[model samples]
Target: MAGPSSFAARRKVKGVQLTIMVVGQSGTGRTTFVNTLCEQPLIQHQQPVAPEEAHLESGIRINPVQVELEEDGVRVSLTVVDTPGFGDQIDNEFTFNEIMGYLERQYDDILAEESRIKRNPRFRDNRVHALLYFITPTGHALRELDIELMRRLAPRVNVIPVIGKADSLTPSELHDFKRRVMEDIEYYSIPIYNFPYDAEEDDEDTIQENSELRALMPFAIVGSEEEVEVNGQPVRARRYPWGIVEVDNPQHSDFQRLRTALLQTHLHDVKEITHDFLYETFRSEKLSRSLVGDSMGAGYGAGQDASVNPEDLATQSVRIKEEQLKREEDKLRELELRTQRELAERRQELLAKEELLRSLEARLADAQHSNSSTPLPPSQPQSPIPQQGQPHPVLTPHGGAPTNGLQ
Candidate 1:
């Protein structure tokens, strides 16, 4: 967590801030996608945002970039939170703890500068609005680990699963990928899209200005066509070239839907969801502690002034003891079952090994017996069994010794 000075530093920035966190595995094109959101010349004017480029007080790596767009007549501030890639280095409990702790620290940071956050950010200021969860293009399904992580995340985060490297997929293949992911985790109901960023190229008067060079470009000024095999027939699916222009192009209906949902519905819902979870989790912990204290005092004689109070204390004690006994019994049963299962497995393994050993021993003994019993018929005579018209030894053209008749 950062010190008060760091909190003050963030508080100084005033605007309609909507934080959109982009997270994913390494090589999933997170940086490219964020650059797409910027919607400018990516490599030219846009500075590269490495994981460690922008540092915060917390150990977690994140780059904060701003995008200005107008929504409802007012300029909207889109704060893209580009997160570090997850892999062998930035993975496991330590990284996860750092991220969660960073999020926790935000609550304190916000409260300290509540007035500034409320006044400065035109959008709802206090919470994370949405999360863009980037995933490697797995044409199969959403993996179990991804779904589980989604489930455990502070439920308020509106997560949109994105398949990076969409250009590699045909239109039909992209649809299949979406379907498989949906089937795997129905709870990941949030929208999904392919990488929404790419280098924008113009195909205008430059063609007229340099006709010879324009001819050199492959498929220059041609309609987009996708090939697919349908019912044992090769088919070319065509779409207007101009239609595939914007990020999450109109040709990609799913991505368009995703963009709409993110900008409209999910963004608003996340704030309420996150706030509720925070309040409820804190409330539950407080309630549990209060109940435990009351139970302890009642059991001790702190609240035993009245004669009727003893019965109440006794009843409470009995209930607690019964619950504890039941838990112990369950634990004992589980332990016993586990031990029996292990013993049975071990016994089966031992029997298999014993059988294998016996078979090997039998084979070894038979081999030894065969070797001992066999003796070379001492010095077989060189003469062949006589047959009517056969020569005993046949000579070769360049022979030092005669060949056997059999040869």
Candidate 2:
């Protein structure tokens, strides 16, 4: 029923919509990386804070910025959700909850919309397709914070770990760091989004490309906004006293490969996985929880309705119970760990206090001993006061006074 011009206009207005959420601590080049990837300033650099206000907790802020971009002659609608001050606080548990809640809320929105009798024509799907977690370039294994965050959120989003400000480390250091990070991820069973391809089913080029990208897991990112002349051509690079680090140089960093994979090659795959797996899983769990709750409230016998299969309902109920127990166990484990850390810190503090007390006692005892050991100089006999007209005696260098003034 639509005319050709109308169809063309609708196609022009509706391009591929992709939402990416970036999470990292401040000073990890998150903003610069987003800007560099977009080839324009999408996120403004955080303003410098005053020293007095530096310790204030700003809490986590979720900001979504929409931008239209063209990649490989295809119009793309991109939404970047930036989580500022995610890991800035001393306790990041709340921050984790905030981020997790945001992701699940998107799913909840979709669920509510699906349940509606009539669909809203202008509703937008803002579910985040991918999450880029910028790991701090510590040149060491992944921190507990990193492991915990990715572990908890991987079930909900496509988490891609990347090392930010990676130019700070040497090539060897970077390689070692990446190896250690991947090892930690494996050890902790963190489900990060690794570029996946089937060796038998996928084409050779696809397999090779994916394998290469997977090997470069936790991509090394060196982003810069400034341009410098390289071979008589201006390139985006961070100038240093020793050399220049180019953003697009494959040898310098993995920015270009990551950009291509994220925007060009694996974009559809990421979205498909999000909808097919993550959202579906969430929806199943949500519905199961609701059904289980209703069944329990009404009595177990009431669950054997004609419309629903008893076996499926029982299976869902058992699965939901297991999930609840697993979540509780996780919470208990986290609490125990936190308590142990606090106890250890308190023990250290007590030991330090005892040491200080002993030191002070020793110093006090030494002072008392010194004062008692050496008696004050014996009182000197007062010399007779000379009369107003009498001459004063001149004391010799020795202990005896001069017998006469002339002497």
Candidate 3:
């Protein structure tokens, strides 16, 4: 037990808030243990199911009950979460998922609360501080149900194993049973809550206290709500024809030690472990999973259901280059068409020039032919008159000359 020195630190505005979840198969005395711990009827007992309702499947349910506890002059706002029908089903794999999902959902709430732009003032962190897992005392070792349940739940919550209905075994049988259960836990490497301490960092008293508590792992618990008067004092106990089992008796059960640990001595440590290590591990795994999915979705947009493919930067670049190439090809074709038209016009001008030159040559040839035909008018000679002094001469182109003046 911690003295005055331990109470100096650790609390919230409304004192320490601790949420504990109890999970086990039915008939494990879960309801009676809660009532015994709280000293009140915090949970109602399960009634016998009728024939019609028994046939129908009742799934595992998570229900929480609130209570205020004053332990060692400290106010604790405690929430007791009860999980019923955990191992009663024919197929219990789904029940494991149901419990695990509830735990993670509480963590998810805190995660969302952290990411909010405007945080909720009254947001409650329902994350479970510790989980008291009740194992049926079979006078042997841990069954598959016990092993599987604790192994799966150890990571998310602080799993503390307790032997339910511990009074069923004799003292020697109970010791052997606890030994076997601890052995199974070790064999399977289940991370049940054992009081942890640092040898070098923690003081000697702290280390001794924690070691003493750790030695009592898998607490043997017997709970009862009925009171029996012993020595004029009413003590909570369970009655049997053989003898009466006192709930708080150290020789009979470990209820008192477990209660003190939970409510007073180690409450702060349990809450710290849950928040610092367990919940942080879950948060890291969840964020890593989401990041992986988001990375895959970046290139393809909204994953499998996306109707439109997101445009990639490389694809856009390729399309732009193709458009430029098409424009350049169009310009080249237009220039080619212009050059062909100019060449055709030049050919037409050359043909027209050749036609005009041929027409002039034909007209010249016709004048020459007309003059040749008219030259036959013949032998008529022209008389020449001499000039200047006073001589006149006439010339004829015949065998004899003929004078024009005489003609």
Highest TM-score against the true fold, candidate:
2
- 38: Cα error in model 1, Å: 3.0
Q: What residue runs in model 3 are displaced by over 4 Å at the alpha carbon?
A: 1-14, 298-407
* Decoy 3 TM-score against native: 0.69
Q: After superposition, how far is residue 10 of candidate 1 from its true place, in Å?
A: 30
For residue 345, give model 3's deviation from the true position in Å. 83
Comparing 1 with 2 on TM-score, the higher-scoring candidate is: 2
Badly placed stretches (over 4 Å) of model 1 are 1-15, 41-60, 88-91, 110-126, 154-156, 187-248, 253-255, 264-266, 276-407
Which of the predicted structures, 1 or 3, would earn the higher TM-score when compared with the native?
A: 3
Full-model lDDT, candidate 1: 0.53
Q: List, residue by residue over 1-407, the lDDT tens digit for candidate 2.
A: 99997787666533698999999999999999999999899899999999999989999999999998888757888999999999999999999999999999999999899768578999899999999999999997888899999999999999999999999999999999999999999999988889878878999999998899999988999999889999999999999999999999999999999999888899999999999999988887677757866866755453445556667866886786688689779979999999999999999999999999999999999999999899778999998888898788778778785565665
What's the true lDDT of residue 352 in model 3? 93
Give me the displacement of residue 194 in model 1, in angstroms: 18
The list of candidate 2 runs beyond 4 A from truth reads: 1-14, 298-314, 317-407
Of candidate 2, the 10-residue stretch with the lowest lDDT total is 298-307
lDDT of 3: 0.85
lDDT of 2 at 169: 97
Model 2 — TM-score against the truth? 0.71
Per-model CA lDDT versus the true structure:
0.53, 0.90, 0.85
